[model samples]
Target: MTSQSSLATEDTPPGGPENPGGGSGLQAGLKNRHLSMIAIGGVIGAGLFVGSGSGIAAAGPAILISYALVGAMVVLVMRMLGEMAAARPTSGSFSAYADQALGRWAGFSIGWLYWFFWVVVLAVEATAGAKILNGWIPGVPQWGWALIVMIVLTAVNLAAVGSYGEFEFWFAGIKVVAIGAFVIVGLLAVFGVLPGSDNPGNGFGHLTDSGGFFPEGPGAILTGVLMVVFSFMGSEIVTLAAGESEDPQKAVTRATNSVIWRIGIFYLGSIFVVLTLLPWNDASILKDGSYVAALNSIGIPHAGQVMDVIVLTAVLSCLNSGLYTASRMAFSLGQRGDAPKAFAKTTSRGVPRTAILGSVVFGFLAVWFNYQWPDTVFDFLLNSSGAVALFVWLVICFTQLKMRGIILREQPEKLVVKMWLFPYLTWATIAMISFVLVYMLTDDAGREQVLLSLLVAVLVVGVSFVRERVQRVR
Candidate 1:
């Protein structure tokens, strides 16, 4: 374990982490079980269910390659982060690593970008979740449901880390079980094992016949990459949550070691089944999202309702994780003195109460946008964040590359969860992420949204940079 004294900088004192409600006897708030589940389910967001349809449409069955390609990048990036996180777990896992490896400016800029990313995400989740609920219960306006969702999740976040863990554990568990079950059933149908199955399983034929591997052409796959990368966004939640673990280092190692496989199987496996069982360009799936089509094709009764419920659960889970992520990132910033110190405050339950509540305000406003201006602000919010995902990922890669040597010099044994090929994979991942960013900027379908997102990301980065410069001069 890293010496507690070493953990403290000017921002964080030696005795405890930067807490909002002063130090509370909340026992670090979460245990191994909660950490494990949040680590698992936290990454499986609505993207798997909804956003995948667009990706498949763009690249056809060959979209699997897109997912695999991005997944490889994720594996390498997480491995890099895992090395640092396992050495010294802290609330600001990646940011802290960036600070140690790069400089105060790098951490300050990236950390704020990450925090901004999730605050926007908080709104997106609420709006997405509220849409499903609003349809079911018309009397409750969509905006009203959004408010309810944010307030409720905010309450969960404020309750305590243990409670947050418990909530996320179950939320993530439901998704794992549902998607896992979907994969098993889909596989049976693929092998012609499902009872009374009349429809012919197309298997690998769907992957090629629809558009062939390069159906939309090599150029289209790049467009597909723009959408596909967003689905992989939540996988790093494990690293962030690991900071609160009782044994932070071990938890970081275990979570990072396990996440690559989990994300690969769940995401790639499910998408494979979807494309194999039904063509990528299938009308029903394209019009209504892939999950709906997969469920309905398998002869699941009330596929729409079933998927609506599943997606609703996903939205809530994402919202829950969004609030948690944003709060922690803010808390990290505050503790590091990168932001106002008030954000570092923790409640009696060791929860970052102010940050949690403050983050949800965006969620509420997002809900309002979804209800009153769905076509304008809400859609822009939805599309804008897709590019920012790439930005956050790129920063992680650079931070890791710079920090690896410092970490090894300080604590060599922490390399147990290290990325294979060391700097090679790290640099490769950086190149891959950079390619995705450039591709997003070029893709016709994603051009406006990506451009706008890039602008927002730059503004945030620039502000953070200037703030640091001023501080240094002072």
Candidate 2:
């Protein structure tokens, strides 16, 4: 076992110093371009494509506010995470930081919770991707498509880290380009610069013209927050993926620095274009996707089909990253003695075969449950993991608060990417997360998601505490 001092050293990976067990057998196989694209595209997922529609329906143009709110929260959390990650550059990422700053139980609990979250995400992304594939080829069943996708991506992850990075690079490239094009074209149309954008609604009027900004009420902004918050879940994939990059510290710092623009342009910018180009009340935005509906409004032919392809890419990217992340987290747990040591074992290729297979096994079962009892099993899985992003963000905030003081006192030179405003903004971000959680409980639509997530969190915590007590007795 490695000491905490060894784990805290720079220029090494997750396990400890540059020793036999260091990095837990993971390799720094990802290239610069792969790191760049993962940094840019990591946050852009199928959620923005499919789920934003519902958020728009719930909060109308005010949904933009929802995106901004969650985007700010994510930016703050990522900044905090970036500070620690740049310093230590752990594959465990937040869990490792939590262990250093909080306790072993914090690391164990959050690590397992994060693993659970992503394993379920694998099933969700696989199912979502399968639907798009099945639509294109009706001969293949949805379950078959889901299985194929999971298997292919699983192979990519197991083959090597570079393969996963290459695949995600392209997947995220398509998404980034698609959204960037949408923003440019939609902005042109909004300003009546596009040739066929002579329609009366082709301006900023739709934002307020459609029952005002808060169509439902001011409460709907919070509702929109709840609806859109989950869309921002995948942003942390960059930090996790950075662990396998050639320069983990540089990768984390670069990714952290660029997060603000990514969220602004890809999320808020694109959504702004959609609201301006089409009325928020339009059925197609929800019936179809917000982006597709906006494209269709501007006479873009086969817009829905085009978007379906991009959404598929996003889904596949999510599944690929999910497997990589969960396996890495499991491997970290093993390294820290929080998980079975077998998971710390890896193939010659530096792939955590045991960890990856364990995560995939649960993913396949979730996909099976999704097919067998779509409503009950899948819904429960979805809700149980729904609020984990928020939970993770909360932990990041607190961990940064404690870790910041330590960094400043013990390792002042390690402060590469510091959080703005020190503890002030950090406290504000925490309060904001608390408000969202409390808001979730009050809102009937989000209450179940919050409750189920809390149950899973409590269960993990309980298990962590039990394990700690047993170890002490032993």
Candidate 3:
């Protein structure tokens, strides 16, 4: 295994030698401003906008705790990723580190699983954006909207990496502005300072008013954790993108350092506004969704429509990043010889056309399944990919453990962004992730998701070993 890993590491240097100018064939198209927005906007997903309602319904006001817990975990995971990425930035990100630290199977399995997760995300976001667009214009069918979204984003990705960054910069900027405005308005209403506000200075009373913070019991916090954890999936996208930036090291360092404020303001802060503006058990929360309901409480006219526009932007942003992320992972896999060689080939402009098309093709198929079999096949795809965020975080913990020692031995100065407490916190994160997976088994819906995701993960790991054996024989 050691020999195999060493050989694999040598064969696939960081980013590969495909382009003489940089680490990889990818160009330095992402500017510092683009990186800043990507880091800020990546945390504020459509899930926080739409899906948090169910989490609030499940855990009541304690949902804030759920968001905080998940937020902290993401911070630690990103720090580990930043340490490696800053030391040696690459589009492959943690997968490349896994190859060097653990073995070939580790890198191959996680890379493909991460790729699978994003492609599925593409379909989900496409459908979501389609629903909103179709509601606005009923003449175009939902499928038509989905097709249009998929094609437009695919073109943006294929054109150049900068197009993706530029589009994301605007998309993420809108989301940040929307949430920041919401938090500000919510605070005003909560303090009875906003003129013409219906919700007059309830303060934290709503936190305990309905059934108390833990209406469902303290156990509900864990349930909320399970519910809200996936919303944080896109937070690490900055690390993957750092490879294509002009100063990969600085971009990663800045992103890693700012993760705390981003999550605090966006997830925790926005959710705090919602809880304070209205009771957790308010019918409007579950009925209209959290953000929209909060806006309605403050006498914001057309709150639903306003939120629809924001959520649609978020969905399109996710779809855009999803396609870019999945394609880049494919390109990285190809660079390492884990995938088709053509995937590593880039256009003159440094766009991985083949990899982008391959990922989008799968995404289009997933969209078709979503339309044709919303409950059966499509549901399975969702469940099978549901636990991937946890899986990726766990791998980063383990990879960082091994990688920390390697870096210290070879070149300690590269450790610009270290994991907080070394092996101790890393182990703690692994334990937390393991506990969540085990906790997931107790709930019917979570159980199905965990089992299905595990089935797919096991199958992928098996394939990696088999491929390794075949290579050894040859």
Superposed by TM-score, candidate 3 places the C-alpha of residue 55 at a distance from the truth, in angstroms, of: 0.9
After superposition, candidate 1 runs with Cα above 4 Å error? 1-15, 18-21, 24-27, 370-384
TM-score of every prediction relative to native: 0.92, 0.95, 0.96
Q: Kindly indicate the candidate among 2 and 3 with the higher TM-score.
A: 3
RMSD of 1: 3.1
Highest TM-score against the true fold, candidate: 3
- RMSD per candidate (Å) reads 3.1, 2.2, 2.3
lDDT of 2 by residue, 351-397 (tens): 88889999999999999999999899889998999888899999999
Give Cα-based local distance difference scores for all models. 0.76, 0.86, 0.90
- Clashes in candidate 3: how many? 0
Stretches of candidate 2 above 4 Å error? 1-24, 196-201
> How would you encode candidate 3's per-residue C-alpha lDDT over 1-474 as one tens digit per residue?
433423333323323356432224777888999999999999889999999999999999999999999899999898898888888777888888888888889999999999999999999999999999999999999999999999999999999899999999999999999999999989999999999998878888999999988899999999999999999999889988987887888999999999999999999999999999888888999999999999998999999999999999999999999999999889888877888888888887788898999999999999999999999999999999999999999999999999899889987998899888787988999999999999999999999999999999999999999999998899
